[model samples]
Structures are given as structure tokens and as C-alpha cells.
Target: MSKKKNKVRPLPQTVGINVPGVETHAHLDMEDFKEDLPEVMARAKECGIAKIGNVFLGPQAYETNRSLFDAYPEVFFLLGVHPNDADQYTDADTQAMRNAFKSDSRLKALGEIGLDFYWDRVPADVQEKVFRTQLELADELDVPVVIHSRDAHEKTLEVLEDYGWSGKPLLWHCFGSDVATAKRILDNGWYLSIPGPVTYKKNEEAQEAVKFIPAERMVFETDCPFLTPEPWRGKRNEPAYVAFTAAKVAELKGMDVNELWAICAKNAYDFFGL
Candidate 1:
């Protein structure tokens, strides 16, 4: 047989311990995984990812792609209209999401929502309106809210504070901000999900924030097909790559990589009720 030409990369399992870990955010149903999704899942399993939270951009994606993970009960979901698509948010979509949450037990949190000021795709007013509407939906359903804040952290904080989300089941996703912002989120009694960007050498702010953030309040995510951590930084990110993030986080906190992996996994389980 002719030798395959694929380059041999380091296995994430080499960096990760055999203990069960959780990937808090991923978009497995996206086109990036379309060609090798099964291989992706197997790699994730080999690296000790016992569970994964697949974030669907909107209710339509959820309804259309929910079946992708039917055989993999280890994969749960996070559904919401992203701030970038605020203009498309409508009542029918809200109702569909409500119905899915009620009927589908795998649906965990209403999230990856909030604001994205870095992108000027949607008008600010419309984004705010859709965000509040989804917030109301999560509150009414008594489910947790997962936030996606970019350069709009201040305004996002103001909205959440005014809505009385302090001490509520809120998670600040992709937390790449400074220590002060992290402290603010912690003060509100919310959990923070650090993403792969934390591994970059230039991200001193994220490093500092992750260093002191209490173990109990900290969790991890890959946000695959987006932010890939170092050692595999320029490649297409998959769930298994979260091990690199765990290693970086553990290094920053002066803890063992395997131990930190398990701790963050447990925190993810608790926060998402997995």
C-alpha cells in the first residue's frame, strides 16, 4: 500500500491526562468538521473529553443540526441568536427554541448570546433588543445564560447588571479580557470560560486573569474552528485541542496540567449541569 501523506502531529492525549474532561464550547456541526466529524469525536474521546457543549448560533441551526449528535449523548448543546445576527431574531425563532428546550433533554444553556461590538454587522439597538428577549426566555425557563461579549464588555455588564443577573447562573464565554473584568464577573458570582487564545504568548492580560481566578469559578473551552491554542495554533481547531489550553492554564496557575484539566472539567459540569 502507498504511504499516506498526512503529517504526523503530536496527539493531544500526550498532553492531556486520562481523566474525563469537558469541552465547554464548540461548533462541531459547522462546515469545518463536515469531512471528518467522526475522526474529530474519536480524537476528543482519546484526549479524555467525556463531554462537549456544541454551541448552535441560532434556533434554526439548533433545529437543523441537533440530530448530528444524536448518537453521541456525550455532546450537549448551547442555543441562541448570536449578537452578530441580531437582525434575524424574531418571535417564531424564540418559540422554536422554547419548544426545543422543553422537548430535548440534551439542550443545556441558552447562550453564546450577548454582544459583539467588535463586529459592526448588526445595529446596536437591535442587538440589545434580541439579547434582552433571549435573556427573558432563559429566565422564564429557569435555565442558565451563556454570554458572548467582545469589545462590548462594559455595555454587556451594564445590561446584565440592570437585568439583575448578579448571583444568577451566568457564564462569561471566551474570557480574553483583563483581570479587572474577570474580577467584576467573579464579583457577580458568575463563572468564566477561558478559550484557546489564553495560550498565546502575547496575551499577558488573559494569563494574569487566569492565574488568579479561583479554580472553582474557572472553566475551559476550545471554540473550535476559531481560536486554536499554541503547539497547534495555526491549524483547524478541534475539541481535542483543548488539552493545550488546559496545559497553558495549568502552567499559568502553577498547578499540574492533568489536575487542572479535571478541575476545569468538574467546574464545567457544575456550571452547565452536565
Candidate 2:
């Protein structure tokens, strides 16, 4: 008997219309969109993506993707060193990030920084140290922070608490935790950035989280080139696809999609001070 062949599904050539929304976290600096970045931005505008938070993984990413600010005025930046790259972080990189945020009006937040036990590319201690340093820097600068926690929710929360993060502008980006985790984040007065996973049929936890998280404390994101929502699960995600996630979240919240869109858009503007 012949073995069953496992065929890889192809991504869609294009996705649907952009409903008015804000993508709170995306890595547009990555090489995924180099060939069609202009087209992607055009589609994002057409789809009603009013603003996009382009997160930088490191200083080099900031330099490489800085042109995006000029190319798309709607694009803003979040500078930070991702936990996976924690080993390469340096004082000079930290200084440059501080300088960039100080000088650039468009640099909105210090973000996508936190623990990721899922991939032990960097040791936990080192990641924790880097995370703490950035958190302290954010506290000193009085700027909002965007955090990325994967399989480290408990530790992430503990650290946030230790840092005295209470009622400040903090966002748990690409929130993939349970309702309990959502409640903890809310209790801290921090915001949650919902991503494409909420649209997945099997993501009951995310759906539940959406139901419980108040619309005012909720925002949508694509985390593009990753976590593509339903109907486009196999595709390369983008800022334009944020609308799909928003629609899913709206469904879960038992509200009209347009109303949810307006709410999330306003929430994003308020959170980022855009």
C-alpha cells in the first residue's frame, strides 16, 4: 500500500475588504513583505486600516524598517528587544532605543517585550533580566509598553506586579491566554490585544476571553505574517486582516461588527495616544 501523501495547503492570493480597525501589533519590518510592501499598504488603506503599530524586534529591525514610517504615515513604531533575541541585547542597543523613542514622535510604545518559554532560544534568567530592564525603562520614560508572553503568563504577571505596574498604559499583545489570564490582565488595568486566533473554530478559550474582556479594554491586531485568522489560516497575515479578527471578537462579544470596530478603533487611539 502506498503511504498517504501529506499535501501542504496554499495561501489565498488575496483576502477580503478591510473593515475600519487598528492593528496593534505587526512585524512589517520582516522580509516577508519586501516584494509587495507597497501593495500591502495600499490594500491596508483600502481595507480601512486607519493605523498600524509596527513593532521592532531590535535596533537593527528599527533601522531596517524605519522607512515604513515615511512610506505609510498611518504606521507607528514600538521599539523593543524580543525575548528570543535577548542574548544579543546590549547597552548600546538600549541607548539607541531610548534615543529613538525620545526623538521620534511616531515611536508610540516600548513593546513586544516579555517572556517566551515556548522557545528557549535564550535562557529564562537572561530573558527575565532583559524584560525587567525594559520594563524599568518604560516606567522611567512614562511610556506605554507592549508585552509578549507565551507559556509564561504566571511569571509575566509576577514581574509586572513586582514592577508596580498598576493602572498604567500597558498592553498584552497577541493575548493567547485563558479567561482567567484575561481577568488577571484586566485586574491590572492593562489592555489586551486580540489577534487572529480568536477566529479559529477551536479557540474556545480566546472566544471566552473576548466575551469577558470589556470592549474598552480590548483592541485588535494582526501580528501579521503570522496567526492568520479563519478562512485565511494558511495565508500570510497582514494589517488588513485585522478586520476579520475584529469581526470574530465582535461575534464573541455579541455586538455588531461595525460597533465593535468603532469601539476598538477608539480604544486603540486612547491606548496609544494616537
User: Over the stretch 1-274, how does candidate 2's per-residue lDDT look in tens digits?
Assistant: 9999966542222334335668788888888998889888877887677889999888888887798668688888899999999998889988888888889899889988999999889999999999999998888788999999999999999999988887888999999878899999999999999999888888898888789999999988999999998767887998877777876777787888778888888999998989
Worst 10 residues of 1 by lDDT: 7-16
- Candidate 1 stretches with Cα past 4 Å from truth are 1-9
TM-score of 1: 0.96
Name the top TM-score candidate: 1
For residue 267, model 1's alpha carbon misses the true position, in angstroms, by 1.2
lDDT of residue 247 for candidate 2: 68
Q: After superposition, how far is residue 176 of candidate 2 from its true place, in Å?
A: 1.5
Q: Write the per-residue lDDT of candidate 1 for residues 1-274, one digit (tens) a residue.
A: 9988976677788894789989999999999998999999999999989999999999878878888998899999999999999998889988999998999888899998999899889998999999999999999999999999989999999999999999989999999998999999999999999899998999999999998799888888999989999878889999999998888898889999888888888898988888
- Give the count of colliding residue pairs in each prediction: 0, 1
TM-score for each of the candidates? 0.96, 0.92
- lDDT (0-100) at residue 200 of candidate 1? 96
